[model samples]
Target: MKTLKIFSLAAVSVLLSTVIIAQSKTETFKVSGNCGMCKTKIEKAAKEAGAKEASWNAESKELTVTYKSSSTNAAKIQEKNSSSRV
Candidate 1:
């Protein structure tokens, strides 16, 4: 019985940790841009919109962002990037 209780507690702890870790999310999508300046602007806007990490590829025109889901989401980041002058 004691061993079973410990196992249950351990399982719960692991589940809680997984839930916490899942709050951080990563997303990638295409973003139109032409130059290094556009990359800078797009990345900056994503960060301003609560992205923890932002990378824009000039050749691929793709932006990959990592952020806390509790603080922000992919749509918000995309909206901010779209409104920016890039």
Candidate 2:
């Protein structure tokens, strides 16, 4: 009886964890810009938009972002990210 209860609790925990992880989405896209200033701007925008992780490679012009899909998406990220060079 006690063992069965423990197993049920473990199962519930796993299910809950799975649900939470499933809700978080990750995506990468190409963005146009240059220099350290552009990198700062891109990363900040993504983090503010609820991205768990964001990296921009200036040489490649690629931005990799991991975020909660429920809170944001690729298009929104790009729109918020694309802005002035100065």
Candidate 3:
């Protein structure tokens, strides 16, 4: 009975820890940009908005960003990117 109680407590602790952890989210979206300079600006804006990683493709006009949901969201990144455009 004591061992059973300990196991249950341990399980609860693990579950709680998992719930408390922040999750990373990756999102890809279209961002209009004309050249390499635009790619740099777009990526920089995403990073400034708390993105862990940001990549922009000039040809495809796509931006992919990874960020923690606890700190920032895709909308915020997109807003920043749009405002940074030339």
Write the candidate numbers in order of decreasing lDDT. 1, 3, 2
Predicted candidate 2 versus true structure: per-residue lDDT over 1-86, tens digit per residue: 99999999999999988788668777889987789988998888878767888999999999999887767888878777764233
Task: Report residue 55 deviation for candidate 2 (angstroms).
Answer: 0.4
Model 1: residues with Cα > 4 Å off, grouped in runs:
1-22
Error in Å for residue 1 of model 1: 14
Q: Between 1 and 2, whose lDDT is larger?
A: 1
Candidate 3 pairs with clashing backbones: none
Screening candidate 2 with a backbone cut-off below 3 angstroms (N, C-alpha, C), the clashing residue pairs are: none
Predicted model with the maximum lDDT? 1
lDDT of 1 by residue, 1-86 (tens): 99999999999999998788668899999999999999999999999999999999999999999999878999999999888763
Model 3 per-residue lDDT tens digits across residues 1-86: 99999999999999887766577889999989888888888999999999999999887888999998889999999998778665
Instruction: State which candidate has the highest TM-score.
Output: 3
Model 3: CA > 4 A from native: 1-21
Q: What would you estimate as the lDDT of candidate 2?
A: 0.83
TM-score of each: 0.75, 0.67, 0.76
Q: Give residue 8's lDDT in candidate 2 (0 to 100).
A: 100
lDDT values of the candidates?
0.93, 0.83, 0.90
lDDT of 1 at 3: 100
